[model samples]
Target chain A: MALEMLSPALILLLAAVLIGLLKGHARTAVVLVAPLLTLWAVWQIPDGVQGTVKFLSYYIEPVEGSPLRRLFATVFAIMVFVGGLYAYRVARWYELAAAFAYAAGAVGVCFAGDLITLFLYWELMALFSTIVVWCGGTPAARAAGIRYAIMHLLGGVVLKVGIEGVVVGTGSIQIQPMLATDFSTWMILIGILINAAAPPVSAWLADAYPESSSTGSVFLSAFTTKTAVLALILLFPGEPVLVGVGLFMVMYGIIYALLENDIRRILAYSIVNQVGFMVCAVGIGTQMALNGAAAHAFAHIIYKALLFMSAGVVIYRTGKSKCTELGGLFRTMPLTTVCGIVGALAISSFPLTSGFTTKSMISQAAVDENLVWVYMLLTAASAGVFLHAGIKFPWFVFFQRDSGLRPKDAPWNMGLSMILFAGLCILLGVFPELLYPLLPYPVDYVPYTAGKVLFYLQLLLFSGLAFFVLLPLMKRTETISLDTDWLWRRAAPALIGLIERLLGSLGELVARGRVRVQRFSQRIAVRYLGQPHTADREERGVFARSWPIGTTALWIAGLLSAYVLLYYL
Target chain B: MANQDEPLHWLVRPATIRKLWIGLSIVLAAVVLAQTVVYIKGYFGVDAWFGFGAVYGFVCCMLMVLVAKLLGLVLKRPQDYYDDPDKDTGHGQDAGQKMSGTEERGNGA
Candidate 1:
């Protein structure tokens, strides 16, 4: 009889407020319960515009339900719960609060029924995620946090402009699927893609995420980009531009990650690569592809968080993140090692892993669409994923030559969270039936055919061979590779300096010309008056004085009359 | 802190590692060979070719590594390449220079 008045998002935001009010074990309990409560709230809302309100001259739907919405919200809720467990022991109380607030924004975005509400929640995520990044409390974190904030704020402004344009152009504020027929729609797509870590600006993900506190990075890995993937699926599915953009991101991520040395940054780049699959699936826009994007986003959040948690434990124990400095931790940190490998295999789309079940659907969609190039590229990228992340991560960090370091396994809560997600990774892969019905579309596609399994095994294993064979070539260096951020980080400042120097010389030349003119005018005034002007300051010539009011008026009139006369002639 | 001279876990010993690598190589060769027996069909004719997955994966990975190597020539810089000159102190552009105190702190090592 009662219409569900409260959204899960509000529950999370309220929980954040409550968390800020409490401390210690009490705050942990609040963190743990809040997400479960939000999940319950998420399930209670039924399909079709659950809550609406009238504002100004327009009506806004704040909560809308569909299979897609529930799927995204469910994963987000799960992320918060697991992420909370991982962070509850290690994070400062404020970081946990900010993370809850960030998750709340992502949850709100999933339920948003209109463009205005979506924009508001989008910016909410930008604000809180920046706070989470700054929670890293290092110089690099501080700088990276500032850059992260600026990038997201710029993206928010673009999205806001698009939303306003769409409202003005269509006379409606509803957030339904639309084509890129106009500037407004394209703006919205570009805005979403930027957050998706689509190229050129994709540098922010790798730059900022690795700098966050280990626990903070776990939360950061889940929310911002995945929310963007959700937005793309909801708002711009079947937009063709995303296909090309996604492929670029896939290869770019692989190459950059291949060149990386820091442990977290490798995972950071791989996140972009993995999201590329979802973005491409959204571009394919078939029911299957949309399902794949949604399903993959769900799988990605779990596996990626698992990976970050494992790495976080390493950094927590050893105080080192670079592969060069970390090796053979499997000796002492066996549980963390196995968990990290599980995450790595999942990410690589190894057979019988969550990735194998979900990611193949995107490639299947690509083939069904007769996108030969896309299908081939996705297959090749799968191999590269294994080479760069699948083998590279576990090999260097856990099982390579000994670096004489013995760090402890993750503490109880962290290990418990990792084990839970690791179990889900396999569970989802083995029983994908559990996931398929939860997709936005009806269930039809199957993932585990014998041929498909064999093909994937061959692809992944050979990539593994390439890794060990090329191990010497892939040695970690004590150097950083340049990315597109170099344009602003180094080149832009140098360009600005050059411009300043040129302007300085020009100003000097103009000053000399003015002095000469002043002397010329002084000689003319002395000649006309037959007086020595040096004797009195008041006798300074017209050019030396600020221009007289009448003279300036006469010059302006003369120029105007000349232009007018020329026109008449 | 534990001394580096302490004995390591038996599984991680250097001799064990060499054996593990040999075992892994044999297992991988078997996996590549299994592709022939299972006869996995591919979407395209080119993909269906013998050892296609292995060849594709190996060649693509090799290209990826080599291209990354080429890129490193231009892209790689001393770890402190971006740090302020004043802050970097002794670690001035030279590879041989010992890192300054500030550089060590910045690396968080």
Candidate 2:
């Protein structure tokens, strides 16, 4: 209770703001110190830190503790530290502030005890992450940031509705498993799926991430979707639909990543692909599968960050992000080249890397479930990952034809951060037990079986072979790939334009009809009033002019005679 | 003038095979060390495990390099691949004018 008295997230958030108040190395020191402090606070969260406080009729539980939560929160904290290191030299103090706030939101999500707490942290993550994207300070970044915000806010609204429905119907706000057959639960699933960059709106990630600043993309790669993965693992484990959706995302990411020419966009697609594995594991819902999802999320954040850092180094040194403008830079930047290759291999699930240990569990689970088709697709996607991100990224940026540009190696801070992440990727891979114990379940699953390792090697190596064999099809171009988001970004806008045109014509016709009616009414009024002789005759005929003295007496006599005649008849 | 015509610009030349061999050797050594650590942890301390690990790593690295070369073929584009030639015509002529100005400056100097 006393620990709850001081919100650790708010403390880090405020510290970040204060850090923004400082300048120079002092700013960097403060930025670096905040995550360390936040990490210490996070480590201090005792097991089962759950309680409820009443807000009117609503009871809110803000702290939930489990190994899964701890795993995600720990990685989020590590990301902050590494991101701070990567960003300290180049990013503005405000951007650092936003990054810390965003990290705090992610950590908050990890410990969120109830739906309300989850939604609160979820929306906070969305808000600060958008600010991080906008901090790129480019017109493109600003537009992408707006689109990102719109998508996230839409996700938040759907999530809020679901949370409210669950609370109203169930009378409890505790975060727990729910079945998909229920309407409220389905809404919640959809809300979280959107954040996970699931289809139909997944374009937001690729659209926004590439537009972020060089440093911003590194931080951007860490939090938003991983948090959604954590939420799904917690709430909707064992849902069959997720397996299908996850496979779609996996292939979707690979094909689109194959099509992308921007270095950051390729990495963004890979994020979706990696998260797809985790989502599938959550769908499996077995103990090993859940652990796989959790472990994969942990490894994903590190390796993805490494990949982004490498891309960031390239962009920072050259001021170019497109793969076409970059090539043959390894001659100048060997450290960056090495770091990128480490990340690439790790992401491709090479036999001795972090991705190999974590991603295999999900595939193993698919096999365990006897889902032959899903397993085969996942195997193909594993190879495709190497083709699109693992090979395409580094090959284009570092080892392609000489572009005659000789940029210096990445700055010391950037190189150091990359090395740290590279080491982490290898550390987790070689010693899976270190990460395995940190998963939510017991550590019974082994990732180093000979059959599994050899299978992965053959699959990934063959994919590598295919990449070499099909190099002509993967050429870089300036054109953006049309994604599901095109439905809203392009098609929706065109539809709106067409509707506006139709309404404009209809409105003109209505106005013309009103004018005609007004003219007709005026003509009738003039015809009735303008004829003076007819008007006078009509007035007299109504007994207005003849009812005077003699006219009134004659009328009275005539009326009396008529009455007598009628009576006699 | 001799230095200018040396044709040994680091940016334009591929890395020597010697350097590639050294780098490969270092990566193999790291993988062996990693396997040794794994073996010592009571997991599978088989004889010649490090050797196996090294060979495995070397093969993977070669495969990755081959993949990288192939990807380059597929993904590589000309520096100006995205630039529109039609739009660049006017700018190209302006650049020509600037080149002439620079040449005049060179002569004047």
Question: Which is the leading candidate under DockQ?
Answer: 1
Chain B TM-score in each of the candidates: 0.67, 0.38
Which lDDT tens digits does candidate 2 get at residues A111-165? 9888888888898899999999999876557767888999999999998888888
User: In CAPRI terms, where does candidate 2 land?
Assistant: incorrect
Poorly placed runs, candidate 1 (over 4 Å): A1-5, A512-569, B1-4, B86-109
TM-score of each: 0.89, 0.81
User: Cα deviation in Å at residue B72, candidate 2?
Assistant: 19
Q: What range of 10 consecutive residues in model 2 chain B has the weakest lDDT sum? A: B39-48
Report candidate 2's fraction of native contacts.
0.00
Q: Candidate 1's error at A145, in angstroms?
A: 1.3
Tens digits of per-residue lDDT, candidate 1, A222-243, equal 9899999999998998999889
Q: Pick the candidate with the highest TM-score.
A: 1
Question: Alpha carbon lDDT of residue A93, candidate 2?
Answer: 82
Candidate 2 collision pairs: A471-B74, A474-B74
